[model samples]
Target chain A: MIKVNQLKKSFNDLEVLKDINFEVKRGEVLSIIGPSGSGKSTLLRCLNFLETPNAGTITIDGLTVDVENVKKQDIQQLRKKSAMVFQNYNLFKNKTALQNVTELLIVTKKMPKAEAEKIGMEYLAQVGLADKANKYPVTLSGGQQQRVSIARALALNPSVILFDEPTSSLDPELVSEVLQVIKQISTKDTTMIIVTHEMDFAREVSDNVIFMADGYIVEEGHPSQLFGNPQQARTKSFIQQLNEKH
Target chain B: MNFDIGYMFSLIPEIMEYIPITLFMAILAMILTIIIGLLLTFMRSSKLKVLNYIATVYISFFRAIPMLVQLFLIYYGLPQLFPVFTKMDAVTAAVIGFGFKQAAFASEIFRAAFLSVDKGQMEACLAGGMTKVQAYQRVIIPQAFRNALPATGNTFISLIKETSLAFTLGVVELFAEAKMQASNTLRFFEAYLAVALVYWAIVVIYSFLQSKLERLLEKPYRT
Candidate 1:
């Protein structure tokens, strides 16, 4: 579980996250949807202590993380519990998909290469890329690369995953396959905070949705109620525009 | 002028003999240069202001002085400057001179390559529980090495040509051998051409290897 209270972040004088508060229950899927620079990615990064929060506390697995209060070593411990899947996949181009997945197991976990590889194969199998595990990122399609990234994260077996625009980089025809993988993930009990533009997918897979704009969480609710009947005028207006375009 | 086929054929066996010496110096110079370049590149990229400044001074100092002068300073000036190194042979001194100078140039190439490796990849590797060194070794270095390869290979080829100047140190390397042969034979044109032919052969071989290496590195990504 993760708890954030009055989290404030700024880049120089420009405030990016202002007095934000949210709590994610264990095994729940929370989707953060917003326009560009709404601080969704920043919030995800902060959860993992990748971004240093300036004026707030984040309790992840009951350990408080902040730039000032947390010890240097504890921040690294927190990062291990939370994995991230980037929109661009971020697979090391030089490494085989399997190496990308097994790197942590061998290096951090100190598992033997053969043992780490067994686990790696299992994760790659989970992502349906087991047969392609020996190939490099450059050899993979966008969807396959993202799956390899997913397998990489699953090998970590973290408490939660933060997906930042996972399918935003994919072709329209390829988006469904990725969403299907995520949709399958949502069926199981795993915590996820997905930053996305796919409202329908959010409605289908998310336990809760928080709509953000101008660095503020304007609305938050179950997807059924939020998408069916948006409470805020801005939320309604934004959905209407998206609906009109579709 | 007319091509002297018989004379050229006669010189072939002698020219072939110096090829290995040329290659040995070039390869040795490159290996030493790459190691030195790697050290300097790491220092330049270090966050500590003093270390970075020291690296800057090193690069500028060596880069500003002509390489030939540096070679002379090493081969000639060192024994005068430091009495103990007087025991050191000319070959070692010249190798040190050429390697260090080439390192100063190649270090910049390495720096660019290291910088170009994705910052995200670095963070990701660290997050995956790799220490900074492990992250660099496993994730960052391989990627950076790839980016640095073409430049490094080019440097090696150029270094082979540059070893011609090692004749200054009295090492009896290829160019020195060529000079001795020319002066003794009284055929500067023919002898020098043979040396040029030897250098050309080396450059051709290196260029071929570079392209092959480029292809091999490109293999995994090739569709």
Candidate 2:
């Protein structure tokens, strides 16, 4: 489980996340759907300390840290507790797909090479990329790279997995393959916070859903309740716009 | 001055004796250059004000001063400033001078290469639980080294030619040996011409090697 309180982040004069707070229970799937510039990605990044919060506190799996007064050890613990799947896939360009997953296990977790390779192969197989394990990120398609990234995140077995617009950067034809991987992952008992624009996918997969706009959570409820019978005018209008576009 | 083809051909054996000396200085200088250059690069990129300032000043000072003057300073000025340096041989002084000067230039190439890597790579590495050092070692630096290969190769080739300046430090490398051969035989044309030819031939061979190295390093990154 994760608990974030009084989280606020600003880039100089422009405030992105304004005193936001949220939580997800163990094995829960929380999908955050919002328009662009809603601070969804920024909020996700702040959770892992990738983008340091100006003021906040985050607790994950019994470990807590005051963001303003954080030490090096706190950041390391936070990073170890969480794994991120980037929108860009961000696979190590020089490393093959197998190495991408095995690297973290071997280097950070201190797992033996043989054990890491075994788990790495298992995760690669899960993502349906076992055949392309030897190919570098440059040679892999965007979808394949994203799946490899997912395998890498899964290999770490972190307390939470953060997906930041995993399908947003892919071509339309490629988006389904990545979304299918996420769909497959959703069936497992994994805690995930996905920042996505796919309204239908968010409704189909997420147990809980939150609508955000202008750095504020406008509404939160069961996806069926929120998507089927939304309360806030903004949430309804935002969903309407997405529906019209689709 | 008439070209002395026969005499130049005759001097080949004598000049060949000094090839190792030239290569030793160049190879040593290049090794020093890479180490010092990477250190300076890290310093220049660091967030600390004093460290960044020191690296900036060092790069400017070494780059602004001529290579010949730098050689003279390390060889002549060091001994004057500190008596301990007087015992340091000409070869050591030349290698040190060339190393520092080439490091200044090589650091820029490395810095640019480091800058060219995608910012997301580091983020992904850290999110995967790697410490800063691990991320750099496993992700960032390897990619940066690949990007830096061609430029670093150029730096090595120039370093080899720059060893010719060791003649001024009383180190009898290829150029110094040719100078003595010229003075002794008074066939300055043949001796200097042969030296130029040797340098050119070495450069041509190195260029071939450089291309091969570039291709090898480029393999993984190319789609």
Which candidate tops DockQ? 2
Task: Per model, state how many residue pairs clash.
Answer: 0, 0
Q: If you assessed candidate 1 against the hidden native complex, which CAPRI class would it receive?
A: medium
lDDT of each: 0.83, 0.92
Worst 10 residues of 1 chain A by lDDT: A59-68
DockQ of each: 0.51, 0.82
Error of 1 at B40 (Å): 3.7
In candidate 1, position B221 carries an lDDT of 65
Candidate 2: residue A239 lDDT (0-100): 83
**Candidate 2, residue B72: how far the Cα is off, in Å:** 1.6
Write candidate 2's Cα lDDT for A1-246 as tens digits: 899999999999999998788889998899998889999999999999999999989999889899989998889999999999999999998899999999999999999999999999999999999999898899999999999999999999999999999999999999999999999998899999999988889999898998888988889999999998999999999888877887
